[model samples]
Target: IKDHLKHHQTQTTCWDHPRMAELYQSLADLNNVRFSAYRTAMKLRRLQKALCLDLLSMQAACELFEQQALKQNEQLLDVPQLLSCLSGLYQRLEQSHAHLVNVPLCVDMCLNWLLNVYDTGRSGKIRTLSFKTGIVSLCKAHLEDKYRFLFRQVASATGFCDQRRLGLLLHDSIQIPRQLGEVASFGGSNIEPSVRSCFQFANNKPELDAAMFLDWMRLEPQSMVWLPVLHRVAAAETAKHQAKCNICKECPIIGFRYRSLKHFNYDICQSCFFSGRVAKGHKMQYPMVEYCTPTTSGEDVRDFAKVLKNKFRTKRYFAKHPRMGYLPVQTILEGDNMET
Candidate 1:
């Protein structure tokens, strides 16, 4: 059964499978049954198998179990006890995002996010459903899949989320950029504006359904922009372009390939670009287009045209015409404030 499931793993996660629903329902039904350690462990093990969880997830679960066992001073087997084990998950999160400059801050923000989303009562305890939903939302899946999963977690039985639920999602999402130190680039850490913008985009509906939620996500609201960027960065990590870095002189530039719009055939490797290294003649302010994937022939032609046009322009013209890499969304509230 495991091997058969593994064959289709690429196409679908266990969460989306019917068997998962059955397993989840069975686990829930266990709550009504009398407490039995053997029964509870067997149910949990089945659910874990269905999740196809990685070593880290399994290890985290084990740690949580140990913590609960030590603290409870009893061997009562319950679903809540199994899921409430977040003792060492923070350290695991830190290790996963080791590239982050302030991993501790990121982990702290994530912990707060968990508490906010799952433990609304501030009781430090969360339901098994909440625990599974939270972990699945943060799993290394497609970005859209994660978005859909998160929305469903907060959505009503009819698959709709009111303003408050949407706000919760946005608030939790903004913490990613906040911890990465990229929140300022999109907008401040305020989530209210983003919620307003989303509702406005959804035609001011009383409750936003999945389709509306997806549409808003497609716009990539300021507060949640960092997630898409993170996905792009991850996708580009192993991407190799057939261009040479003019500064580093590395052939077949690996990772992000940055092409200068001002200079013909000028390219910079990801390392050089991040370090702010420029060749002798190129200025730091000169506009450059970033490519996570390799450029096509048509793109090469278009870039050539852009470079030709830029070459004729004066330095002052280039300075005055600065290019932004991302689309900036101005909410109605912000615009109204600007007028006031």
Candidate 2:
């Protein structure tokens, strides 16, 4: 009995034992489940306030959208499933009758454009060049401002707006409030209004985080319902600002500048090149000509080629007309760095 007591004293308790640690963790988790849920609700409320969206409904719609997207992509869709999905989408779209009429046309246009881009008997997958060019073509062809902004997000120097960003942007911007309850049902009971109310009550104060809001805004290109109005405004704003040089990032407000053919978004100012302030990655050997004004002269072709060869010797520039005695070149005078 004394030995047993001594052994018991030496032996670690269940709480101290590593083997029983998982139970304590699970207990702690169980205790905090309500708190965790409350925190999530608060986050959703904040997101809702920031975006002017119903978070619960948005969550539901997102789940449905994702499920449908997955099912459609996986070749798992039967006729009934396809019809049901279509009906759901149509029903959701009908709430915003204005968009319902235009969405189909836009989808059809995008599909047709994608098909044309892959017309070379190649794989169904779109190459990066094809994707970029296809977006440019779509933007030019579509009269809708929504599409213009969408394509511009991808085509402009703002940077690449790939598939994920596109999905997230559309998910957040497009409202399908009518379908939210149905979507939530599909997601589960966790996002019900009653539960969300508890979360809102926990932190019932107006707290605006400017940086977070800015970040969200940066991702969202524009609102769908106000596209037409915003489109005209955007066009005017675009016209007011000239394309800046990619190297110096200066506009041609004072004089002409050159843009690179190698990259769709890259351009260089004469001042930057002359003053050796040219940003890296814009190869000097890459052909750049004046975008808004003429800098090319037939007389300076040979001298220009020599100068170019000397200046960009580190990089390779193949002459398109090798047999010709000389190639035509453009001359551009340096600009003031202060003006850059």
**TM-scores, in order shown?**
0.57, 0.22
C-alpha lDDT score of every prediction, in listed order: 0.57, 0.32
Per-residue lDDT of model 2, residues 134-160, tens digit only: 232222122233244333433325444
Return the lDDT, model 1, position 193.
74
Across residues 212-321, which tens digit of lDDT does each residue of candidate 1 receive?
88877865555665455555565676799999999989999998788988999899997777656889999866778888788899989988998999899888986675
Question: Which portions of model 2 show Cα errors greater than 4 Å?
Answer: 1-61, 66-75, 94-340
Report the C-alpha displacement of residue 128, candidate 1, in angstroms.
6.9
Best by lDDT: 1
